[model samples]
Target chain A: GAGVSQTPSNKVTEKGKYVELRCDPISGHTALYWYRQSLGQGPEFLIYFQGTGAADDSGLPNDRFFAVRPEGSVSTLKIQRTERGDSAVYLCASSFGLGADTQYFGPGTRLTVL
Target chain B: TQLLEQSPQFLSIQEGENLTVYCNSSSVFSSLQWYRQEPGEGPVLLVTVVTGGEVKKLKRLTFQFGDARKDSSLHITAAQPGDTGLYLCAGALRSNDYKLSFGAGTTVTVRA
Candidate 1:
């Protein structure tokens, strides 16, 4: 009955540093997704994983962004050489499996690249 | 790239008033969803409509999907102060079931 959750609710790092955001999906959820939300904007898709494999990463803004769901139930979003422009709220969501299923969200991790 | 545009990006109204928010896109989607998010929290799914021209209701909230599957609308009746928050529309493209394209969102503030 637990909902999705993200760790390090807030992170602040230097522009040239690296940061990793973590997500814990609902129990038994086979699909997970990562998204980024800028202030006053809706969340933008980043990547999706189905059973530990990234099914789609097209939404990733660039090579600096990467995500992995190694065990299928948990995921990590990694940002390399972060830029000040990369500052935003990183959101994670998960679903039971496919198509029409509702993707529940996590509280999100706010990353500030100083 | 699919884009969902939400109109009247900001709305403020008194309690007990009725309001409607719209989401439109040029690209057709297989399904569309509405979510409500408050400050310091993640979005919570309100409803999902998969069939063209489909309509679903959640208590005081009503949602409609366009016949062409390219748009949707959310209407709230007799809204209360508790109804205030950000309304977001997300669409799942025909090409990918796992990915969602979200609108910029409409921020609603219902005053008592």
Candidate 2:
């Protein structure tokens, strides 16, 4: 792909419902990341992938959140039992390398869990 | 926990005026990056400063990294209405770490 692409640009769901946001990173991008940005706040690191496996999932808030990049090119963020506080914009970024390189971000998916 | 704090959470000025936004943190960073975001759009990278005491210029925008690598600033010369947007600062906790810690951001509005 020309750039990082995210799916379901907007998702609205009720509390307790599960939601999944997808990201399609640039071709051959080995590093994928997921972040959450709330109103009036910067993007917070949610998870990071070095390849097909998660190298750093420390940023995940709790067990309810999970992300996976099966092929190292596309990723998915899953939220179980969504809550109102889960409302925010989820951002996906990809870089050619794990360090020192700039990250290209997608348009983001706005999730509103009512 | 490492954190970046941006000052003057909101700034509004008339066109042609100059403005500066600061990002401060207690911990040092291997690299710091600045981004500008508009409403309904993702943040766009403006510049990245890696070494301490480094300065870079992009047209009217100037970025400076502190000597201690714990702070950075973004200065705009002859600001325009187009410069109005949310400015963010992101830093890495460790050398070559992919994870970034970002500041809450500074919102600037330049009146036409």
Candidate 3:
């Protein structure tokens, strides 16, 4: 793909509902990342993947938020018992090979929890 | 945890005016990047600074990385109405972790 892609551009769920967001990184990119952005704020790091495994999950807000990249090409972010506070734009990015390189971003999925 | 702080959460200026946005941090970074975002779209990369005290120019924009690598600034000369958007600064952790910490961002609205 020419750039990173995200699925379900917008999502609306009730409180306590579960939701899944998908991310497809650019071809040949070996690094992927997930970020969450609240209104009027910058994107906040959520997790990072180097390959099939997650390299860093420390940024996840809590256990309620989980992300996985089983094949290293596409990733999914799962949120359980969604809260109103979780309403924000979930962003995904990918870099050629990682290691502090520039990252290309996707359009992002806007998740609204009502 | 490394944190980047951007000043003037919101800025509005007239066309032909000049402005500078600042990004400050307490921790040094291996590299820093600047981005511009518009409504309903993802952020687009503007420039990246790797070496300390380095400056890069892109047309009417000038980006500078502080000597300490903990701060950066973006200066725009003779801004135009098209420059109205959100300006963001993100940093690459110095530990080679590949994690990017982004500043809160500065919303600039350049009016004609």
Candidate 4:
């Protein structure tokens, strides 16, 4: 079985630009999550979707960050007016259900905002 | 807000050595997960401890959850070079099990 995967393994954009990162979760999985990881730091939660709706977005740093998981399988993390501070590795993961379920991750998309 | 703090942010040891990493938090969680991540890759789940004072083992790795559910520890027995990587602890709050708060992580370097 194939694992979770992310597109645009690497992305470089100038400040104030917009970028979208994509994620493809495992087949039949109903939950998807997005996280941002800075250098030498663990991944920070961003947003999570259960089915087609976002169950939680509290972890999103600000209004500039938004994510959508339409169709209940694929998701996208969108950053508007990106800042230099926004540069980091964007990770996507999925689980079979909810709490206590093992989360499988993707290779991640490294976004560099210069 | 629940915050998980991992101890010994960095560790280096020779192969065959034994090591333990700790994760502590003031807030209690319904479940805790341990993950190992290699450079340029996303984290891979090692184990998940849900019941308080429960212990789970994965080959040479051992995981323990505190009785209060506010802490956990990962211990490696006869560590090997393959065990080297960044170890992270993430906790799921009881109220919001879908949201996971991760620790800063501990980088382990096991030399052959």
Candidate 5:
């Protein structure tokens, strides 16, 4: 079966610019999540979506970060006025449901704020 | 916020040697999971432990959850070169909590 996939494996942009990262979850997955990983550190939770609505978004660092999954299978993470501090590997994951279900991850999109 | 702390941020061992990585937290969790990640790739699940003081074995690898459910350890016997990667420990606060709190992770290198 096809696993999760992310587009634009790597992206480089200037500070204060905007960038969007896309994620394609595995077919039939009903839950999606976004996380950010800094160099040499573990991934930090960002946001999560159950079906078409965001079920948990407390992990979002600030208002500048937003995500949408209107159709429930695909998600996009948008960053507004990106700062150098936002540079990191953005990872997406999905599961059959939530909770104890195993979450499968994508290769991730490396975002570099220059 | 629940924080997970992993010991020995980095470890290098010769092939056929044994190694252990530990993760601890002040908060109790309903479940804990271990994952292995390689460079340029996403993490892959290794195992999940739900019961306190429980132990699960995978090949030469063993995972143990503390009796208090606030700590866990992963030990590998006779590690091979394929065991080189970053090992991460994550926990869910409740049975229904989808969010996972992860440790900083331990980078392991196995030299052949």
Candidate 6:
């Protein structure tokens, strides 16, 4: 079976720019999540979607970060006016359902804000 | 916010040696999960422990949740070079919680 897949494995942008990272979850998955990982640190939660609606978004650092999964299959993480502090690896994961289900992760997209 | 603390941020050991990584916290969780990640890749799930004081074994790897559910440990016996990677522990505050609190992680290097 195909696992989760993320596009633009690596992206480099200047500060104050905008960037979008894409994630393709496994077929039939109903839950999706996004996380950020800084160097030498573990991944921190960003946002989560259950079906087409975001079920939990408290982890989003600020209003500048937004995500959408209108069809409940694919998700896109958008960052506005990126800052050097925003540079990190953005990861996407999915599960058959929420709660205690094993999450399958994509390789991730490395975003560098210079 | 609940925080998970992992000990020995970096560890290097010879092949065939045993190593253990610990994850501790001040808050109790309904479930704990272990994951292994390699350079340039997202984390891969290793095991999940839901019961306090429960122990699960995957070949040479053993995972144990603390009696209070506020800590966990991963022990690998006679490790091989293939076992080298970053180990992470995450916890769900409630049974239905979708978000996970994760530890900084332990980087284990096995020298062959």
The candidates' DockQ values read 0.67, 0.80, 0.74, 0.68, 0.84, 0.89
Error of 2 at A103 (Å): 0.8
Interface DockQ of candidate 5? 0.84
Output the number of the DockQ-best candidate. Answer: 6
Which pairs clash (backbone N, Cα, C closer than 3 Å) in model 6? none
Candidate 4, residue A57: Cα displacement in angstroms equals 1.4
Query: TM-score, chain B only, every model?
Result: 0.96, 0.97, 0.95, 0.96, 0.98, 0.98
Per-residue lDDT tens digits for candidate 2, residues B1-112, read 4399999899999999999999999999999999998887788899999899999999999999999999999999999999999999999877888889999999999999
Which 10 consecutive residues of model 5 chain A have the lowest summed lDDT? A94-103
Interface RMSD for model 1 amounts to 1.8
* Model 3 whole-model lDDT (C-alpha atoms): 0.93
Q: Candidate 5, after superposition: displacement of residue B112 in Å?
A: 0.5
Model 3 ranges with Cα > 4 A deviation: none
Kindly list the per-residue Cα lDDT of model 1 for residues B3-22, writing each as its tens digit.
99998899999999999999
Give the number of colliding residue pairs in candidate 6.
Answer: 0
Candidate 5 clash pair list: none
Model 2: runs farther than 4 Å from truth? none
lDDT of 6 at A17: 98
For model 1, the docking class works out as medium
> Could you tell me how far off, in angstroms, the CA of residue A7 lies in candidate 3 after the best superposition?
1.2
What digit string (tens of lDDT, one per residue) describes model 3 on residues B18-109?
Answer: 99999999988889999999987789999999999999999999999999999999999999999999999999877465778899899999
Q: Write the per-residue lDDT of candidate 5 for residues A1-114, one digit (tens) a residue.
A: 499999889999999999999999999999999999999889889999999999989999999999999888899999999999999999999999977799999999999999
Which residue pairs of candidate 3 clash?
Answer: none
